[model samples]
Target: MEAVFLIIALALVLMVFAPVAPSDRARTPLRLRLARQLHLWDRYVYHDPQIWYPRD
Candidate 1:
């Protein structure tokens, strides 16, 4: 019982913290998905303008 609980907890932690690579170009962490949904992920994570914007 204890081992099962520990495994579940570990899986949950990994799921929350791990970075998810989608089929598209972006790779985002699960924990920051809320911020991404709110359009604040890049603002807080990428400080440089060049990171979010590219030169044309």
Candidate 2:
């Protein structure tokens, strides 16, 4: 049926565009993870936007 074909087509499109999972080697250590999170929070979340923009 047309409905079945449409569902299959949508599933195929989503499969092609889905994000791949990070590999084990891509995982960061705990200290680095915490540091990155804190840095982002400080720069973006807790900052005074009128005085600062994010650096590259």
Candidate 3:
């Protein structure tokens, strides 16, 4: 149970920093479907980080 919670928490953290924002170019039906699922998952289970982490 603890491991499951940790994995879920990690995914939520990653969602907050989604590497790319899907836009018009990603609007094709297939991509749209994928994006929709991801967005919904983010909405339900995501948590924004308390601090932004710098990237290279």
Candidate 4:
């Protein structure tokens, strides 16, 4: 009975603290990659000093 209780307790501890393995699925899809490029020009404009002067 004590052995069974210890086993259950150990399993509960592992379940609570174990890190989940990441899935084999891709994080970003092809559609999202294409959509991200659409904002590339806007990103460059915002970050470029030539387009917008940075106040130091």
lDDT of 4 by residue, 1-56 (tens): 79976875576555444444457854565455445543664576578997577677
- Segments of candidate 4 deviating more than 4 angstroms: 21-56
- Residue 31 accuracy (lDDT) in model 4: 56
| Model 1 local distance difference test score | 0.60
lDDT of 2 at 19: 46
- Model 1 is weakest, by summed lDDT over 10 consecutive residues, at 36-45
The residue pairs that clash in candidate 3, if any, are none
Each prediction's RMSD over C-alphas, in Å, is 15.7, 14.6, 11.4, 20.4
Q: Write the per-residue lDDT of candidate 3 for residues 1-56, one digit (tens) a residue.
A: 79987886687566555645456455345456556656876765455443244354
The best candidate by TM-score is 2
> Runs in model 1 with CA error above 4 Å?
21-56
Q: What is candidate 2's lDDT per residue for 6-55, written digit by digit as tens? A: 87557555644454446655555656655655576467545776545655
Candidates 1 and 4: which is better by TM-score?
A: 1
> What does candidate 2 score on TM?
0.38
**Cα lDDT of model 1 by residue, 4-56, tens digit:** 76875575565556656656877665547645433553454467777569798
- Candidate lDDT scores, in order, read 0.60, 0.58, 0.60, 0.58
Worst 10 residues of 4 by lDDT: 12-21
Give the worst 10-residue stretch by lDDT in candidate 2: 12-21
